[model samples]
Target: MNSSQLKPLLSIGNKLIGFILFVICAFAIYNKVLQNENLNQYGADLKIQLSKIHWGAWVLMGCLMVLNYTIEAIKWKSVIAETNQFNIFQALRAVLVGQAFSFFTPARSGDYVGRTLFLAPGTKLKGITQMAWASYAQLLMTICFGSLALFWNLPFLPWLKWVAPWGAAFAVGLFFYNQNFKGWLSKLNILQIGTGLKWKLIALAFSRYLVYLLQYNWAAAMLSIPVTGLDLSIAIMALLFFLSMIPAISLTDLVIRGQLFLLLMAPFYHNDILLIALTTLIWMVNFLIPSILGAILLLGFRLKR
Candidate 1:
């Protein structure tokens, strides 16, 4: 087709994709927020909690959320440095775009899709390949720290004693494997990259994880969940690990997350409503808010020629 003919088709295609994304995100919001009975009830309870909140607590959490995503953006910026360096703003936009799509996809596969959209046509595939390394770095952090939480539970559930060590070993092995795998990425003429990148990636991921872990614990406290210190830390870690390792589809993932939080928190706290409210609040602040912003960005999303 001539450029004139092809241009219209491309426009239509982009619009179709945008429309589809909007629909998927809307469905997710409806299912997870609007239609959720648990959240609906929690909404009423949250109003009461809101009155009692120190407002400053939210300001701090908001700041941490920014820090958390900024760290992630910098990590992405570093990973793509050899291929195409992005400024902090560009990198942050790519990460938020990924977050937007992640809301409607299993295991957030849309993260790669959204991220690669910012790459040059020639570099987009390699961008995705490198993203795999970036993601592995983050997952390794979760598995390594999360293993301790699992091991802590071994006294009550002896089976974890058998599983935790092996799981830790496998996660460690994968981290090293990802490092060696960079050589293969280099062979693809796509990775022109750095030295000691693996350690850098791991360190960055750890920092980001720590920020969010602290945020989770703080959120739980604000909601009056009644667990603290080491116990709270373990529950938060376990929740993060579970959410990270398991794959769930679209809006349904929110439901699964709610259930998981309840199970993890139930042993320590008797108030199911309070726990569920806390979980919903965390979800709203972290996932839902950024996603709404991303959807607004998606309306103008277009593929580069």
Candidate 2:
């Protein structure tokens, strides 16, 4: 197909994918709320649980989330040090705005659009390509560490076992096949992907996962979930967050995370409803809250001219 013809076709495909994702998310929410019936039973009391949350703990979690974003911005700055003058504030804004887009859009292409806003107009595309590479590097590191933790904990759920290996392989393949990786490395004359600044990038990426652990731990604490022994919940939640990146699923993350919590923690908690509610609450706080704020910020402020 000609370039113009192909553009329209691609747009249609993207829209179709988005529609499917919405339907999936809607279905999951419906089933979780309606078919389960139990969710509704405690739906009233859920507000009480929320009301009981310690403001101090909530503030601490919010700070950690900002730290996570800052670390990501630093990582991106490291990757494109030569190509552009990386500003931490700009990077953080882009990251949060990108995250806002990720919440509702299928596959999170919104991240790219948000990141592009920060780039100098002339080199927006190049900056975007580099950002994609940096993201891929982070994903690879998360999967590698998360896999080790997954196997170490070896949760009671049989299906959970398959997630680690498959995720690891896919992440590795994605890194190797990434066009941006090749382009960035070539432009910078970097021979080894794991050398110098790249190592720092990976470290920053690891920090993001650690930050997530803190966030999840705090969420568990808020829900009065016991934190004894090695906490595998963080690793499992990280895995779910990673899975949410895959395109074509509507609200798959919201459902999968809630369901997985029940499967993995129910044996210990003996309260599936509480676990699911906690998971859902945490997801809403982490994803939905930021998205709403980002939308407001984007609308209220003007971009750099």
Candidate 3:
């Protein structure tokens, strides 16, 4: 089909998919708020607890969020180095713009588009594809380790067990499909399909994730929630991270994550609602802060000519 024909079809399909996701997210939010009887009292207590938050901890968390963005910018630059040279500031701006797009778009595919717009004219498409593939590799590695952690934790929830295998299979399939594992690369006539520095890209991505985990841990501490075991926290947080990868969930992403954390850590903390409330607060800081900053960055700066 022609480009014109394909564009409308793609647009319609995306809208349909986005509508479905919106409904699901809305339903999940309604269920969590109304049906989860335990949360009502917890919500009241959470409000009281939040009213007593220490400003010092809030400041520290803010600094960490800035650090997270900085590390992410570095990671993107590392991936881009394989294809072309771009200034760190420019790359960082691109990252922010991409993030802003992700925040608004259902599937967050706008992130790729925003990033691509930042590339030099001749190699834009290739650069975008390469960065995407490299990012995918890192996520795949995370899912692999995370899956193992899940199994080890032996989460009683059947939904938890189902995620690991499905995630692993999807990651594996993506790797082979993108790489054309069966020698399909030759058909494309491209010199390299990814950023040449695969290991560095992976390292940068892995380090970013580590920072994210640390950020969450610190956030939990800030809320004075007791962390009984690192192993379980890691597994649960990893699962939360995996879920965040699913696009178009809206704020359901944060709510579901908070709920899951509560479910998994229930054994450790007698006060499940308080912990979940704390988790929700931490998630807000992690997501909303960046989103607000990214929006500012998007509005204030003009792309360099």
Candidate 4:
């Protein structure tokens, strides 16, 4: 087909894809919530306990979810500030839209497409490559912090302490490589952001990571999980760290997610259903709802190339 004819076809295809994704996310959410109502023999008991909890706690968690993504938007905005003209509000919109695309994609890579759409068409390709830098910064935070929690959890094996120096070496390697990469990209005119700014972005990533931990902790407290302080934090980090190791689509992840949460909390709290309740809340607040929001936002995307 001629480019002229092909453009219209592509626009129709894009709109169809958006509508399909919205349907998938919405259906998955509805199905899962229906399951919540008639979960099992324990459904009556679960609802009774859950009913006793104050509505305010759920409101606070929803607020924290917004704050969580806001921090992500800030990191994204800064990285592309040298190229894109997006304000923080626009950046946030991109993040949520990215979440929608990410809901079903492998390893969540569709997020790149979602975020890049916010850039001017001329710059969208460059924005994709540049966005990876911010992503890497957040991942490096997970590795560094998760590794420490790993070391703490494995204290019985003195040899495991060897992970410390390796983590240090990895950190040093990151510093030198970042410095070299910055200059190379500068020479090539690929990206002009500073090494210092990159580090600041990593700090912001950590702050968002902390917000995640707090939300989980708050949920546990509301359910009276009976685990707190360092014990709770350690298990939560361990759960997240290990969970990140597994790959699963958000829509299909609930069963495994709940199992992992149970395994991690088994040592501290044995109320299986309550722990599952915590898992359900975390998944819905952090992933499902935001994804649905993003899918709804997809309707606003310009269908034309």
**How many pairs collide in each candidate, listed in order?**
0, 1, 0, 0
**For each candidate, what TM-score against the reference?**
0.85, 0.71, 0.71, 0.81
lDDT of 4 by residue, 1-305 (tens): 79999988887887687677567756655665465432454567667767878999988988999999999999989888877877888899999988877766777777897788778768887788678777777766666666676665543445644665486468646643644344546564454457787778878988988998899889888888788767667766766665666776664466667777777666677888888787777877888789878878776666434
TM for candidate 4 is 0.81
Range of the 10 consecutive residues with the lowest summed lDDT in candidate 4: 175-184
Candidate 3 residue lDDT tens string, 1-305: 99999988877665465345334433433443454433454668777777677988888877877776776777777777756787777777777666655554566666776677667767787777676766676676678667766665654765776677787888766565444333655756463444346656667767767776777677667667776548545656556545746654335565666666766665566576566766666655665445545555544333333
* Candidate 2 residue runs with Cα over 4 Å from true position: 1-43, 153-194, 234-238, 241-250, 300-305
**Could you tell me the TM-score of candidate 3?**
0.71
**How much does candidate 1 score in TM-score?**
0.85
Which clashing pairs does model 4 show?
none
RMSD of candidate 4 to the true fold?
Answer: 4.1
Q: Which pairs clash in model 2?
A: 21-250
CA-only RMSD, every prediction: 3.4, 8.3, 8.3, 4.1
lDDT of each: 0.76, 0.63, 0.63, 0.74
Candidate 1 structure quality by residue, lDDT tens digits, 195-239? 488788889999988887888788877776668767877877777
Across residues 1-305, which tens digit of lDDT does each residue of candidate 2 receive?
Answer: 79999987777665465345335434433443353333455667677777788899878877886787789778766666665686787666666666656655566676677566656656676777677778877777667766665665545655655777787888777566434445546765332243566567767877887777777777777888775425545446545544644553224565666666665554456666556667667666666665555554454333343
Clashes of 2: 1
